[model samples]
Target: MLEEFVSLGKWWLPNNPEVVVPGKLSFSPVSGAKLELIGSFYSSQFEEIGQVEGIELPSDFVSIEENFNLTSRVRIDFIKPEEIIILGLLDNNEEITLYRCSGRMKSFEFVKNRPNLLFNIACIFRKIHFQDEQNIKLKSISVQYSHLEQWIGKSGIQAVILEEENKIWISYQPPSNIHLTKIGSLDLNITFSPINVNPFDFYLGATYYKANIEQKTYLTIQNPGNQPLDECINLLISFRDLLSFAMTKPTSVISVTGKTDVIQTKPIEQANGSITLKEELRETQVIIMFGLWNSEKNSETKLSPNEMLFLFSDVENSLGEVFETWIKKRETYESVFDLLMTTMYTPSLYLHYGLINIIQALEAYHTSKYEGIYQDKKVYEKGLYKKFLEVLKDFPSESVDNENGISDEFRNALKGKLKSQTRFTLETRLKEILSEIFCLLPPNFIGSLEARGLFARKASETRNALTHHDKEKRKKAGKGQELVQLFHTLTVILQICLLRELNIPDDSIKILVERNRVYQKEWRPSSN
Candidate 1:
């Protein structure tokens, strides 16, 4: 056995071959090599332990692995106390096997030798295995649904289904207090069947549907499956009944405040009401309770402050035309549309998470369109490599050779050592890639090159802060309103980028971007 040697540095191994000893337990005079070990490696007897008497054995265990204790005593050359020394065993073949020691350094002693100082080190190795077994633990899981209230219809009602043990529970919750007059006329039911087992169906009639006079009522359906509940189960709901229940609304009175008088009005709720078609319409007070009222020309109607109504037949038609065109190029725009819709429909509370998702979606779309261009060896070497080098030139040096009075050759060697191992930070890398990609956009589309660069930097910083939970940076990134503006800005820019990659007409893209409310914000468009 050869005497064990030690290597020391910030990292486990040094990159400088000149400093490393070849086929021997020796090294060059390095300042960070605080200590060296000279000893023979030895192990104590191996011990086997059986299970406790009358205890059940684990199915996976046949026999417990033997445990042994390893110990070594070596002469430690204590060059510096603060620097850490990692000891390893060097074999006759010059192979170094480092010890995975959990024990701390102990029992330090000084040996006098003037400039050639050393210390006595006695390292102890203990083998202890502590395994924790718990009966139960809580885990967070995500739930996915096919439809949300806002996307389907603005009914303000949501349905969520959760699984526990062998039962599937479906609950329909209302946002506010409202009467369900059609509760008696409606049929509420749930059909649950495990695919692995026979069909298990459950139904609830109008009598089972519960409701209160003033407060909203929650309807729940619980169906126990015949088989054990796995991680996920296929669930289907009868949408006809659910949609009918969602579309019906309770009648309410409206009060209007006038300059001199207060007017209270009641709406006529007819079970079966019919309206005659008219070609022309004048400016008049016409209140629509429910159902579509079609018109060829525009007519203005006064509405209450809190009344929510949408008048966008023309806008809808225009958007439908654009969507039809996009569908023609579905492969180009489908992913972008999916992510954009997800961001748009994200709940207000999780807008930050939504922003991050949109950013990822942008990156994905960019890679999908231009990955070949970036990954081509010839193109990369000729174009992007030079650009990458230019960006790398701006990175600050992280040299570690100034403290000792070393020779110029060593200094230059260390400088080259630092340069060879240098790499760009994540933020710098993202900014460079984004800047290069955005350069392909139409000229002046994203303002100046400086603007593009700033966009990448800001976007990367905000994303990193949000991801790494840098509270100070995140707080300074923006308030809720500012984040909303930033979110809209990012979404619009990504949409535009996707369209441009699809080779859509610039005029059509401009029209789409300008007409959308998300792009109408005051925030300037940037690469982020």
Candidate 2:
């Protein structure tokens, strides 16, 4: 009979339901079973002996409930039986009835031809007391929250919580005083219910809900509203409570919405991914919205909706403007900018790549300047001969011919042809090429050659170590601090190169270099 009911119930109930019905039995087979329960009932027995002889009859009473007894049962249907079926009866409507009953199977018997199995059930029942619900609603609230130690800019964070009957709604507004007016991309970290309970359980809307304990999730919206800049954006989230231990398990839902007066509002898709912000020539404004559902586990628990908004704007600096100018003058400037932005964002990992790219950019510029010079056969031959003569200067006159297997004429021709190649060492080449690019030599160099020389040497060594796996040299690099310093110095060098390419005045370039050098000491690699 129980098996028939269990099969019928399985077909009648849905696989997963919002609410579970009462008197549902979920059964699983086991190998052996043991059940035990103890109960005590108390009563008093009194006997009066009537005696005419005695003036007063003494009443005698005995306590009948003082004895304690325990009942335990274990049953083995067969020797090494195939299986033992365990049954559990659920009182799903305990919230309405204010009562709970639990039972376990103690013994089982299987008959050869009988369709139903016989079993013994022991159950315990208890009544529950109802708790009074406390409701709290706040019209406006201010909450400051950040992924890092403090908020980035000087914007104030504000939030609000609204509760009507069993529904909860929260909204957080970020600071509006953004430094920029446009945004390219953004990332936000939202924490829901910083405490233990899952706030999404109370979500009360049409959206799907996935249960997460102490839920902390991140939602990123890109190209928001599909406009250049989103003027208004709204996000809705819903949560349903599966466990109904208190207050009938109210569903909580919230929506985060904000508007900006910026132009070119675009429609964006909602996504659950991360976006990396890059340095841009123009300022880009971004807004991050955070929604939180605050609730405690108690009859008089205070449920509050809290939210915070963060506004950030990426503004251009002098160095960035110089890069922008380079983009117009040089065809390869975009590649250089990509490397620079990558290094700026993730310095510890790609700073070396940035350094190498700067060198390449300078080389490209140099090659382009002398491209026409090399195209002229007369000038090319003259330059080649000049380089051959310079190479000959390193050897004694008598031994020059015997230095290699080639004759004097062939050797000279070969040296001349290869004169335009990279002849100087990396460090020497950096200093020499930088000197030419910046038009600074003796007394008016943007930075001291001695200081630049040191930087060049360290940069060369670090690059070599990173490329060739020089353990000793890498150990001397000292935990990337020197690498970061070298990266900053190289950045300044590139900035000077860009400024010179734009026909900027030498004095202005020097002033910019000096100003940026101060920031070098405090600049550290960031992964933001």
How many clashes in each candidate?
0, 21
Model 2 Cα lDDT, one tens digit per residue, 135-175: 01111111122121111233233334455555444433333
What is the RMSD, in Å, between candidate 1 and the native fold over all Cα? 28.9
Candidate 1 C-alpha error for residue 46, in Å: 49
Candidate 1 local distance difference test against the native: 0.35
User: What lDDT would candidate 2 get against the real structure?
Assistant: 0.35
Model 1 residue 476 distance off true place after TM-score fit, in angstroms: 6.8
TM-scores for every predicted model:
0.29, 0.30
Report the lDDT of model 1 for residue 59.
Answer: 54
lDDT of 1 by residue, 1-528 (tens): 011234332112222223332212222111111223221111211222332344454555432112321111122222232212223323432222222222222223324211221322222111111011120111211111122122122233343545555544443433432221211122112111112312332333224354322212122112222221121111111221122112111111111000111123434546578544434422221110111111111111222212211111212323223333444444554665556544443334387788787776666665555442324556555675656556445534445334534554654565454443333443445455546445444445446667656656666667777888998787546456656765665655665565554455567555544444423443444335
Roughly what TM-score does model 1 have, to 2 decimal places? 0.29
